[model samples]
Target: MRIDASVITPYPTFAYSVLDRYIDGDIIIDKSSALIGTSSGIYAVMGDETNDDFAPMLMHEFKRREMLNQRFTLFSSSERWDRRINELLGAKLQRMPRYSFTFNEHRFMQSQRAGIPDGFRLNRTNKESLEVNREFDAAYIRKYWGSVERFADKGFGFFVTEHDVFAGECVSIFSSEQYAEIDIVTNPLFRGKGVAQCVAEAFILECLERQITPRWDCGLHNTASIRLAQKLHFAAPETYSLYVRK
Candidate 1:
């Protein structure tokens, strides 16, 4: 069943990426309930929690199709939905804390800036640059956007390179009309340096120009990511539960 995209409220940016057709994904609707699944194995459940039989039926279908695996994480839209998922998954579910941040323009502009190292150059992701970095390579983009061509058309990223070596990259892992979720990776050799910030700043600059809200999400244990986000002036950390298969 197909449901109106407007009905699936309070979803993560990735789910919106799916719902808005910015990326390829699976959508299943049953009466007032809906499930949106992305290629990266993240799923969002929204609407009527009283539909007790919906989730189990979908689980059965997933198992039959061999798609019920340990790699998937589930996001529930509300507390009632959370309880429903817990009841359905039982001991197989492990809840983890995820932190979400809002971008603050004034703080970002006020934050200390990091200049690209003398030999380093920041470039937007293109056919040539995508082939240079494994972290933001064709495979990674395909995993999120379904195809390199689609990503090239709708998505944008920035990567830093020193001579010919890839230093770090920041890309929109998922996006919709109004939001772009950030995913960053700094090479081990460039970890202590500001390559991440520089590349990420370029990505943010483009987002601001495009009128898209850049979003940052990280797990509680990823202290480094949290610190970097704070340094980039992404404020108001709100914690949410992410249910993983155990």
Candidate 2:
């Protein structure tokens, strides 16, 4: 009963083509849908919608995503499979702030504007600038920026940075789904000096302005990413393992 996700198409192919670069391993495709689950990080489906009857398949996927964790499942969801997800979420968020990352919405935005250094600036993509910028991530960033822009009306926005071409462009993603994902890749040439942190703080502020949640997630082994998240008050971590078909 395999499904051909490519033919049944849920999310657009254009988006997946771009994200393919970030995909780490082998992919299993079914006519029903494509499971872009992971064993190391966030397991997500790209705008995929189908197979609402995954109850029988939930546990397999949980294991597929490495959520079984050799002891207790670390990540999983079953459509009416169990009362566990609700229980887990309730316990995890209990007594914690409604929005673990929501602090001063108004003040956060103000702080971003105030903290801008004399030479540093942030703004939306200018097609003209992207057309001529022949740098490393410049082209990719332009593409990525455009991808995020399509969803801008859905509460996603990106701000490009050119402080150091070697360090790569700073990146961020805001979603109505209670998260402003911060992704930064600082080239080895620009290792330290708080550039990533500065942008992270600013990104958070932007999400706050739009009243969305800010989530900072990284591989457990990436201590540097964990440290940066902590610095920007995304200290709390929700740990989970993922699996990629071989």
Candidate 3:
């Protein structure tokens, strides 16, 4: 049976913890688990792998709910369900390789931070600045960060500006008590000038100061992101699989 996001809020997975805040009723909670769907597709599933009915129940409800599409990505936090999902879906889907990396505070402290270029200023994202920078994509910001007010309270972000114009941003795409996933973008005019790196460094420092580890996850093929993560001192990447609609 479907229940509230709050009902599954204590599932003990980083994915679920992050989803809890923005689900806003776009989820299904059974006795022991929950499935969250987004406009893009099934975003994540959280439950006990040991439960015999867990996988089946998830599959059943996912079909019954008529989620956005038949083909989409699903995040799995447990290995038990990974095999079960693969066996059930088989070649009807494609397995995509991705990387998950996290910061080691000790190692990060020993690394060198990138320097921001001259004439650029870094600032924390706030309601006032966000309004002034009308160029920032409103829909994209809302979809990833939720309301700007909530972001200010629960997450952290930094943006680099050049002569009072927006240049780039490094923001927490998903955050739980223990970790904050980093997301960054650079304006075309500012690309190749290291603006992204500087902003990302600011975001990382904030996370470290607050004792929250920074996380970096990206597709294996995303070379640019991989380079940035390595440069920022993220630990070696670990491989994981997810499904993409065929």
TM-score of each: 0.89, 0.49, 0.77
Cα lDDT tens digits for candidate 1, 2-76: 655556444688888887899888887888788888877778888787886587765764453346443577886
Q: What does candidate 3's lDDT look like per residue over 29-128, in tens digits?
A: 6667666655435456666555666667666755654454444567765566577667766555567778888667777678777778888988887767
The count of residue-pair clashes in candidate 2 stands at 14
Kindly report which residue pairs in candidate 3 clash with one another.
none
| Candidate 1 runs further than 4 Å off | 1-10, 61-71, 110-112
Would you list the C-alpha lDDT of every candidate in the order shown?
0.81, 0.41, 0.68
Question: Which regions of candidate 2 deviate over 4 angstroms?
Answer: 1-149, 155-168
**What's model 1's lDDT at 48?**
84
Worst 10 residues of 1 by lDDT: 61-70
